[model samples]
Target: MEFENRDEYIIKKYQQDEETMIQLYVQWCSNHQIDPIALYQRAYPGQVQNESLLKAVEEKDQESIEISSDTLLEVLQMFGNDDLAFAVTEEIQKRSKR
Candidate 1:
């Protein structure tokens, strides 16, 4: 449980909470009528390699788009949902502990 750095610990937790992050991403995207995959790609560009996640968005599958926590927050903020983005980050940090 000991982390060498705070960022390392936060990244670990963020990865652990991928499902929650994806849920928040989908909800935010749906609420704003934005394409989750497009937003994710825009946030990370060539860094995105999750075909399943992209496929989910391409197919309009709301419940299957699994986005990374960092990408989700970036996309949210990109769309001007700073409050919701912060909430999602807080929720992910909380859920990762459990």
Candidate 2:
């Protein structure tokens, strides 16, 4: 409950809750009907998109996609969704044991 280093905690928490973060990203992509990897590429030109993520989106295979914790944070932050990003990070820490 007490994090001496909050940023470190957040990073570790994100890694632990990677599945939930990926699910949230998939839901967001589905709701917006936009491939998150593409969107990320557009947002940060010259940045390589994740091939697996692109393939998953192209194939409409949500279950096969795996999103990195950093990418999840970046995409969410890029879309101006600090609250959801924070929630996902916190949820990862909270639900890690389950």
Candidate 3:
């Protein structure tokens, strides 16, 4: 799964797009059948990027989220290492209760 030098460069460049980030949010939510807002609230701990992404996805703003393959890759990252991610989220939630 190692990327070539060019591939890594492309991924970095691709990640620079806000649209790519938004699309990742959309795909991850769709794959899990959760609303993007709820998915962000549950999976990621902050409102900055995730909430913005959810808004972009749900609003269908047609800004460019759906057109980026790099975005799709980011969505996969949210779910792929999901065990650790979810575990951390749970702890955060638990701590919030105190």
Candidate 4:
């Protein structure tokens, strides 16, 4: 796809990266048997739904990828999703105690 300007290209690249991040999150949740939507809702209580998350769920393929807890947390934090990152941390802690 062609972008009109450098800014547009940057934005497009960020969006694509964000999508990858979301996919990674969803896959991580699946790998751990955690509900991604429920986790997202726990992070953002005000929003009933996350469109990108739902889309990722719908589009997820059979292939599975390794998503480390630390990597997922760092990626979420890097994307400015501190709340979600915290939620994931809490989840990790909860799972560790089990």
Please report the candidate that would top TM-score against the real structure: 4
lDDT of 1 by residue, 1-98 (tens): 45568889888786556544455676556655556666565555657466646544555544544456687778667656576566666656765797
Clashing pairs in 1: none
Clashing pairs in 2: none
**How many times do residue backbones clash in model 2?**
0
Cα RMSD (Å) per model? 11.5, 12.5, 9.8, 2.4
Model 3 per-residue lDDT tens digits across residues 3-79: 58889988777666556555555654454444666545555555456555655676664344232333444454554
Candidate 4 collision pairs = none
Best by lDDT: 4
* Model 2 CA deviation exceeding 4 Å by range: 1-13, 51-75, 78-98
Ranking by TM-score: 4, 1, 2, 3
The RMSD (Cα, Å) of candidate 2 is 12.5
lDDT-sorted candidate list, best first: 4, 1, 2, 3
Q: Candidate 2 has what TM-score?
A: 0.38
Native-to-model Cα distance after best TM-score fit, residue 28 in candidate 1, in Å: 0.8
* Residue-by-residue lDDT tens digits, candidate 2, 1-98: 36768878988787556544445576555654445665545445565665545654565654544455567778777656576567556545655666
Each model's lDDT comes to 0.61, 0.59, 0.53, 0.93
Candidate 2 — worst ten consecutive residues by lDDT sum?
60-69
Model 1, stretches more than 4 Å misplaced? 1-16, 55-98
**Local accuracy of candidate 4 as per-residue lDDT tens digits, 8-58:** 989999999999999999999999988999989999999868788999999
| Candidate 3: 10-residue stretch with minimal lDDT | 62-71
